[model samples]
Target chain A: MISFLQIDLPALLVGTLAALVCALIGNFLMLTRQSMLGDAMGHVVLPGIVIAFMIAASTATWVMLTGAFAAALFASLLVEFLRRSAGVEPSAALGAVFTAMFALGVLLLEQSGVARTSFDVHHILFGNIETAIWPAATGLSSLFDANALANLPPQVARLGFGLFIVALIVILLFKELRVVSFDPVFARTIGISPRLIGAIVVALAALAAVVSLSATGVILLVAMMVCPPATARMLTDDLKTQVLLSLAFALASGLLGYAIAVLLPLGLGYEISLGAAGTIAVVAGVFQLIAMIAGPKRGSPRNA
Target chain B: MTEFREILAVLLLQAGYNTTVVMLGAAALGAATGTVGVFAMLRRRALVADAVAHATLPGVALGFITAVALGFSGKSLPFLLAGSALTAVLSALCIQWIVTHTRLNEDTAIASVLATFFALGVVLLTVIQTLKTGGQAGLDVYLLGATAGMLRSEAITLAAFSFIAAAVVAAFFKELTLVSFDTEYARAHGFPVRVLDLLVLALVLAVIVIGLRVVGLVLIVALLIIPPAAARFWTNHASRMTIVSAIIGAASAYGGAALSAVRPDTPTGPVIVLLAFAILLVSVCFGSARGLVIRALGTQKLPRRVS
Candidate 1:
């Protein structure tokens, strides 16, 4: 049982947690018609991690997370600036920022000789979940698990918990989020500050993304976040129902993808290449395909 | 002085090789993508190029794997490109079918095809890597290319194919333009719009497949988009735009290669993209016909009206 817990639970827990976090934030992105923004932010986070490592000389999660958030915010601000001031297309602005920032991060990494330790950064873009180890004991114990099972490595639990908090907050303010997502002008007319709501959603999405980077890696996270919700949109008209279905789809994919990845060596003659996060993304994509064919007669009304 | 002269001679010789390979390859790919991309852009299918580009990854990997399976003497660049081209064209058609047959909008169809195909590519690539198959580790480099790998043969093939492809475009330029800008007009005019559309798409995928040796798949969309976008800034006529776009594409290829040669670690794709962007900036700001500066300066200041 202990061996089973060690072998099965870790992968299962991490995959499900990643899917939950991605779904929580993904709904907002899909609603805003900014699904690709996750991909842009994923790349933009690189310069932040690089800069943080330069200054901090440590990979402590909090420092890196803050650095990533700041950089992501700056990039988002720059994208908005380009859109407003320069009249550059939004996608063009996104492409420019991510490419330039990715280049800058590479430059910094090479210059600092941190490339040796930091080369895993590229792998971090796609992720390597199998090698990830459980966190050390934090000395905080849950009454339900006196053996401290609840205190399992933060990596296994943090993403799901973070997502739960985000989902709760979103639930509490569901009306505002929906109004702002669909029609900011009308939302503002109703006394909801659309801009504030939009900013909060973008920030939360970014925070969720930063946490996701620890698991899914950067390159693949956008797919994980966007695909499930986008697929969900195809199956339903109700915005609320879409979110619920997307969560179900995402979590189911995580579990199935993890199981197949684990069973690859035994069932197939060869070992599979993808880790849990990638497998989950692949599974989500499969779900989207099935939904496309078997889905309802119409895609949902525009998120607005 | 003697040492300086010898070194200069060697550098100049190498630079010439770099210039020819880069320019020719970019021009061929640029013209092909431009021709196809015009249709894509006019159809408002800009993102499809991105999707197709991503879609090519697994095809390239599979082609490589097949080449290995056959125990080929060489990497079989042409075969690899052909496979990718086939995959890409099929994927593009699948996207079209999904949009038409299913209730899915263009965005969802495109997103689904793009993500699913790319995820498959990533999964296959990882599996191959884990197998320790004797191949390059950064096969993804084919997705994000560095032009330092270009050789003499690739350049010649690109140049020759581009010239032929350009001639085809020139001969059919009027028909292609007619179809791209207004499919309804082309259809009414008795043009074979569907055939022409497929031809243009075929050419574009061909170029993308071949060009992967240099700029790779990810930034290939930039090649397809930026040159035409920049060229559009200079002219409204499709014929002139195609010509100018080809020139810009080749010139950027040259410029990027030259700069990358001097800047040791610089990847050619980003530099080329930057060059294209720079051209766009210039065209946007200073082009004689429709540049921002001229438009802003020429027009009388009017009271701004908010929507």
Candidate 2:
């Protein structure tokens, strides 16, 4: 029905954009072998947002974003500190710092009664995009069935545009991200400070989290940041190929999920909450499975 | 003053119940994790636990949705637990398959799994919340948990499960140790290393499920790692480590529950993890083999050669 098409188009658009952005971030995470670090940093953002709200006297979107960004950066720095000084393994150090910080955040939220607020922990974990509208598209029909030209909601369109520009910038500066991801030691020898690159990546990652959290919620943001690139890596080793494959994977999953959610009645009951993020993950997983089994065989054993 | 004593009396009485339930639950969970943590850590799959924990979130969400759809009371702890366990096990299996079939490193495979599954879970959780029409925010409670409301049934189930898990560990102790330290040696000896590995993983999954009610998914991994890690400081033998780890785990559970009871409304799992970490720090400083203070004082007081 025309009505159904109208309803599903926005879901597809937002989901697709979210997945695309996640895949872009995921590529770099995969290359660095810091995939779980995304989850750690994401949870670490909880306290950041809570602190921001506490100080700002409001949960205004920008204020929360700034807080989440600072917290994420702090978590990244904390991990680095633990790794260098405490001699903790990177994953273990991440575990220590983030979990501790999150516990503190939870305690603070409980004390402040933020857990009961509208923009509370629950909403932040699983986002509510139902009321999320594209501000620029007021009184506009962004969907046309004849040519099947489905336009995105205005704000979503802008976000996608911004995301595309960011992706483009990263691509133009691909050398920077690649050098930093591939060999920090070598990059440092050749005048690139891995530390600086790491800081930039962390900053950009936090920025991505801030953007995605509005849609996906804080908990699921890491999925977008880690899944696509990881799946792409299963099929290819080259960084460029991985990024390309990740983007493709993200797009396919987002579109497919949106289509499925449209077709199914469960959308009415449960909202298919994961939307694009879930779809991207599932698709990436499926792609990995296919690549693992059907791809060309290698003679080398696994733990070798 | 009388009102204060009455409140104190009620809390102390509740503390007795909380301590017994939580310690038994933590010990059971700790024993299973200690048994499995050894192999995963030995295999250099330490981060795999993180991945598995992250991946399980979707399963928990899915389980909750399924329970709701089936018209079951949302508070059906067993159903929720079952749903989470099923998804977690499936995720683990998927990870194993990916590792075997793909050229991706263990770390990469685990990371990818962690991300995708967790993302899916987050998205679903968001969707669920958005769609909710009323006051029942069932999913939210599972995030950090409110152990103050833990029922008798939940405690009993954890204890029973823990005992069975411990029994399994005891029966297979020799085989697990042999296989874990040297899978190649086990393979040469025709010890079915793959089967043993699967058994150990199953035990780990069981521990995770049992702990879900108490610690929830996010922090349960901490309990698994910290207790055994602390116990490691005290003992070199695997069996002893498992026993001591369970003791440390149980002590923290009891201690945390008791403290929370006394202090009214403190989070139990974090407190327990803190307690475990405290034990670890203490053992690290004063335990026989690796105690820093003893080593430092030993170095200072050593009978060095006169020359």
Candidate 3:
């Protein structure tokens, strides 16, 4: 139990927190028909981290997070510019910008020889979730100890803060976001700037993506952002219910996935654990699949 | 002076048989992707290829495991690629099903499928690591491509498959153009719009699977997107646009491969993508048809608006 608390608890907390934050913002993204923007942000975060590492000469969490956030913002603005100015379609613009940024990151990573040092390409892709251990924790009692709390992995704190910010933004701007997501022309007539709300939502998503990145990596971040909300969307018609249900789904997937990753191998007599983030993503997918088949609105003609 | 001469030799395909083959293969893959990408973009399915590319991961891992289990070398390119094609097609169908059956939009379906499938691939990869297989070391090349270490057989297979894909696009050119330009009209005229859509997707899958060894999956979508997108700025005519897009794609890939040959540290996939983006940047600014510069020039020639 102590070993599990020391090693598994912090990793699970970080992963679950990451999933929650991403899914929270993902509801709005899905409603706005911009779910792929999460994918783009996830891809652009790589270049941001690589550039941050190059500039700061350090891998501090804040530095990398800031870099990733900036990159995401820049990519978003560039996509907008391409759509408006260059006459590019939104998806193609997004595809071009993010891939180019990602390619740039990979190129910079190779040229800087960072792949040979403390960081590697796989670390950037799959992340180091298994290494997020809280060595100071002894058991459940350690949760109340100040020292133990201080020794908690940085990812847990970052992701916790991210979830708080995302939830706060969603709560505070719920009406405006909904109006813009459902009817931009109506929002404009009512004096709400859809573009500003869109930017805010994109910024919030970038925040969730950058913070979740260390725990879930780029690919799993997209899954967490997309799958949970999509599952919730299938089950519910109300936006609030969708948001709440998505959070529940994200939490459930995280816990179950982490448990399966750790315990399944042991039960089967294997010595190795599966990738926790990937397992979480797969579990989230399963949930979505189930909802698609059996949800109340699954076969509704409203969809057509 | 000698370095310059060597680069020139590489450019001219005089850089030895291995280098020549790899460059040509990349070029062929690029041309095919560009040709197919035109219809995809016209049909607004450009990002579907992104989802398809990402979804190839689990297939690759499964292929590796299955090959090893069957007592074949896990590095068998054919088996691995066959695995990827199966899943790529599966993922496409999943997107179609979700979009058609549910309230979810295409973007949401693409994103969810991409993330889920890639995550499964990652899980399978970890499983592969635990198997103690010696041939599992280079499977990551499918992520970002390592053209420098490509086998001769792999290079030939890539080139041949790419040529076939481009030819397929050429053979179906009129039908595809009609479908992309006027889907409703094509449907009314009795063309199998749905099958052609799948055909476009299948051609895209073919390009991605073959290009996996050179450009890698992550950036292969760029090959399918950037060249055609860049070509769009140069010509309004579909046929000319296809030719221009293919030329741009071929040039970028050929140049990138040669450059990677000259500098072993530079990976092939990123270099090619960067080269393609540079062309896109140039086209966006100064192309003859829809270039920003041309637009600016045309606007300047207009008479001043009355107050």
Q: Judged by lDDT, which candidate is best?
A: 3
lDDT of 2 by residue, B1-307 (tens): 7646644654444446655565455556555565555555555555666667666777777777777788776567777787778778877887777667666656667766776676667656655666554323655545555456667677778778877877888898899888877788889999988798778777777777777766666666776666665666577788887788777776766665555555456666666666666676677677765566666766777767432
Kindly list the per-residue Cα lDDT of model 2 for residues A231-288, writing each as its tens digit.
6665665789888987887787667655654445464564444444455455656665
Per-residue error for A202 in candidate 2, Å, reads 4.2
Clashing pairs in 3: none
DockQ of 1: 0.33
Q: List, residue by residue over B1-307, the lDDT tens digit for candidate 1.
A: 7645643543344556665566556556656655555555555445766678778877887777777778862256776776687778878987887777665556556656766677676676777777655654546557656556566776778667767766777788788888888889899989998898777766666667766766666566767666665666677788787878777776666666555556545556666666666776687677666667766865645434321
Model 1 spans with C-alpha error above 4 angstroms = A1-12, A60-114, A119-121, A135-165, A179-200, A269-273, A296-304, B1-13, B16-39, B101-103, B178-200, B235-237, B259-267, B282-285, B290-292, B299-307
Q: Pick the candidate with the highest TM-score.
A: 3
Give one digit per residue, the lDDT tens place, for model 1 in A105-213.
6556655777677544445545656654434333233324645565555566567656777888889999999888778889978899977887888777777777777
- The per-model DockQ list reads 0.33, 0.29, 0.72
**In model 1, what is the error at residue A224, expressed in angstroms?**
1.9
DockQ-sorted candidate list, best first: 3, 1, 2
Ten-residue stretch with the least lDDT total in model 1 chain A: A134-143
- Candidate 3 lDDT over B82-173, as tens digits, reads 99999999999999899888888888999999999989998998888888768887798898887787877888889999899999988999
Off by over 4 Å in 3: A116-118, A139-141, A301-304, B1-8, B302-307
TM-score of every model? 0.82, 0.77, 0.95
